[model samples]
Target: MAVVSACIVALSGCALPRSGPKDDEILAGSKAEGGPVNVVLVDNRVAVASYLDDNLSFPSSFTGAGLASTDTINPGDVISVTVWENVDPALLVGPGQKQAFIQEIQVDQAGNIFMPYAGVLKAAGNTPEQLRRLITRKLDPQTPDPQVEVRRVAGDGSSISVIGGVGAQGVYPLVPSTTRLSAMLATAGGVTIDPDVAQVAVRRGGTTGRIFLQDLYDDPRLDVALRANDKIIVEEDRRTFTALGATSTQARVPFPQGRMSVVEAVAEVGGLNGNTSDPTGIFVFRREVQSIANKVTGRNDLGENEPFVYVIDLTRPDGVFLAKEFQVRDKDTIYITEAPFVAWTKILTATSQTLSFTADVVRVGDLLTDN
Candidate 1:
């Protein structure tokens, strides 16, 4: 029994159950498969700044200024041309007819429209007024004074496609009033999801860019102008982080906002468990890029795929402030370890339970001997 008790005492550290790894255990397992562990102590301003630098943002490709005019004629637009000649014999209409009304004339793919007597004229890149003047010049030789009026109607080339997470998903035309992205979205009916979590992706030509729908409301500059053939998609934000160990709740929590800090993420999971949480062992695990890993760990030799663990101790005076500034990235694992005393209590409780079971067996043997 003495030998068995001695063995149990020596092996208790390895055999004890735990909610998650301790701080030292996590550090000891940093290196794996020949890659060095990049443990970053996020207790200072520098470390917090390094993590904040990795925030997701709208690139320049998405934020550039867009064209202000939506009235220009493009291919596949429907145009209407009406001609009125005051002379006795009209060049475009019959002798008795006072005016010629041509309607529903669709612009061809080459951006040219044809009139009965005016021939084919370039209509694209010209506003309705400009195109009207062009047509008047074309018929001026035949008639003394030709008055031409050009009207642009809705068609394929002047419209955009709005789909996903909206009240109505379909093709919408870009008129004078609905030329901006927000106006187009409003025409299609507002987003079906929460504006806070909604993401809007704009695909123009060969490039695509995504931004939070709420961003358009926050900064009017981000409300980009809509163009022909542009595809806009609205969807929910998919960024998330995992919470484990001595937290009050353990689960995968989605980002409540576009830019979230470590402290905010902790609060999303109901904060740390009061009974077993170790304030000094709060950690955020991530697969970090080489440049950011170098900045956080002060190591130039780190690889792009290295694993990083950022530690934050709430007991320090600056810890809470650091956590507030340190950004929580997508796919990060936020873990709070159990207190040291909790493990010792577990060991004591297990040993007491074992001793009680052993005494019960011995009493049973004594009863058999008496029988």
Candidate 2:
């Protein structure tokens, strides 16, 4: 997931440059209108660090018809019976009498439920209403009419857990018929920005399955239903920003879910130091090029692929202008070298230019001879 995100940052960082500044005045005007991008790595700033954690609600459509056929009943299920002709005995009555009125059913591992005169009947594959009918038929010989309602009491109809930025960390009950992963996240209060919607994982019976959260929004089918004992883990979009040389502060800034650009990262670290900052040395070291190259060839080794590292020179008058628009990536290292001699060079150039103009107009012999 991080690899995919990093590729996006690298691709977005290098948008074709616009036409050079028409004039100093135009450059100045553009500079004033647009400030340099402060795309710093996410650090302590919660606003910049946090991503949106959207909770999906229980889908209204995952009903009885959506569930697949399965034969699996669990214990600890609660059931109630309406006896058409049995006498109602209070709990305070003789223990035997009270026990006769209530039958606490327990299903064995074999997927069978115990009921009066029913011995052990298969209840796993049957829905509550279906189970009720099955039990009713079994008791027909003993009782003229028997009404039964079997429902889940302690087990998930089908569930998956949500951890890392979720409101709660327990298993979310899925709609028995067709509860999807999206619905489970909703039931658990969705994910937090810190744990954005990058990837949604579902662990089922020792096997783990994953689906992209964004895919759910694009294709509703991706919000696959949750199954028993499935676990869902969400990863934040931002993790590590690569650090580069010479900047007073060089460290990975943490970002929440979602991607940020190189310029935005610069701002995140606070505007560059006017004295030590060299805009040209600023770079975004990315591995996307190599990863893509490796994929087609089925090679795991880094091979001949070169990680793209963009080095921007801020020494130019207009360089500062582009930094504001360049995107940043996580774990990006920004290096700034002090301006190599711009101050002295500019002063010398101005003085030399003036001297040349004076020499051209008036010969040195003219002043010396007159004196």
Worst 10 residues of 2 by lDDT: 16-25
lDDT of 1 at 129: 98
User: TM-score per candidate, in order?
Assistant: 0.87, 0.55
Give the alpha carbon lDDT tens digit for every residue of 1-371 in model 2.
55444544453454322212212222233212463221222222322222223333323332222443222444434444444433344222342342234445555556676665677778766666787788778866665555455555445434456786566778654454335666677677776643343666666565565545665666665666555556778765445674544454666666533445556666666756666455655655454344432442334664443443344555666555455445455555555544445434444455556556757768867877899
Winning model by lDDT: 1
TM-score of candidate 2 against the unseen true structure: 0.55
User: Candidate 1, clashing residue pairs?
Assistant: none
lDDT by residue (1-371, candidate 1, tens digit) is: 79457646864856687888888888776653333666667756555556644433455756676665777889999988889898877777787887999998898999988887779999888999999998888889988888888888898869999999998999988887888888989899889998878899888888887888877888887787777888999988898999999999999998888888889999999998999999998999888888877776666987886788888989999889888988888899999999998887787677777777878999999999999
Model 1: weakest 10-residue lDDT segment is 48-57
Q: Could you tally the backbone clashes for each prediction?
A: 0, 38
